[model samples]
Target: MIEVKEIEKKYGRKKILKGVSFTANKGEITCLIGLNGVGKTTILNAIMALTPINKGQILIDGEPLKEKTFEKITFIPDAITMLPQMKIAEAMEFMKDFYTCWNQDRATELLGFFRLNKDDRISSLSKGNTAKVNLLLGLALDVDYVLMDEPFSGIDMFSREEIANVFTSHLIENRGVIITTHEIGDIEHLIDKVVLIDNGLVTKEFNAEEARENEGKSVIDVMREVYIG
Candidate 1:
């Protein structure tokens, strides 16, 4: 499980996260939802310790994040970081050399799962396939938790659907996932918990299935009430 407790963050005088807290249990997909600059990305960054928090704590599986903890978790940023000139197979090699946790067989499986050719150059791949490669690199890591920032952004609908399918597939089974996106239309069925953030604070947090079963509220239904009412 990934636990974020009362986290506070500041950029100069601007506070980004104000007393934010949430829990993402293993085998569940937790989504952090908000509009632009509402501190959704900041929370992911804080969890990975890419940015320091001002106060409070973040823990993974009951322990605070440490250098060794990185082996147990991986972060897939909003965009790919590798050089665009590299071929897909070469890119996989890069991961193998860099990360001891890289699983070649699993990467090969994901390569097929995404319907991508190993020989295709990154620069020539479609936006959707590029995103798949980015995700595959992270997912191929033998880790327990995955943090994805806007996996569906800037992609075609079919591509977004393909990405969403991975959440339900055996590839990600039993692995904890925390994803961030401004829009929830594509992944409404894939998420287990929704944490809504506004004005740099958590406005609401609820189980998606519970909300529907008990209140007859869809994610958008609840969002409409939170943001509009």
Candidate 2:
């Protein structure tokens, strides 16, 4: 479980996150939704330790996130710009050596499942294929928390659907997954929990099943009201 307590962030005099608090439980997929410039990415960055929080704390599995806890978590950004000249196989091997939880079989399975040729160069693949590679690497890591920032940014609808399916199958059971994306339509069914952020603050958190039953609404509908209503 990851617990974020009263987190705050500011760039110079402008505050980006305002005392946000939430607990992302194990066995749940937590999706963060918000309008552009609402500091959704900032929250992920703070959790990943790429940006320091001005206040509050983030604890992973009851312990604060530190350099030593890196093996327990994995963060995949929207786009990864690895060496363009490297082969797909080469990149996988490099990641295998770096991350302790790297599973070679899992990587190869995803490669085959995605129909990506290992001999192909990263520079030659299409944008959506590149995103598949990024997703595969993160999944193979087998971390407790997989933080994805707009993993479906540039993919087409078909590819996005495929990627979403991969997410459903690869999620480590009893582990937490946090994804930040504007295209909530592709992932409504997969997400177990929703955290709505606006103007750097968490405005709402709802369980998917509960919302559907009690509110008779979809995640996107609730999001429209949360961000606009």
**TM-score to native of every candidate shown:** 0.96, 0.93
Off by over 4 Å in 2: 170-172
Which regions in candidate 1 have their CA more than 4 angstroms from the true location? none
Local distance difference test, each candidate: 0.93, 0.84
lDDT of 1 by residue, 1-229 (tens): 8999999999999998899999999989999999988999989999999999999999999999888898899999988867899999999999999888899999999998899999999999888989999999999999999999999889998988889899989878999999999999978998999999999888999999999999999999999999999
Query: Candidate 1 has what TM-score?
Result: 0.96
In terms of TM-score, how similar is model 2 to the real structure? 0.93
Q: Which pairs clash in the backbone of model 2?
A: none
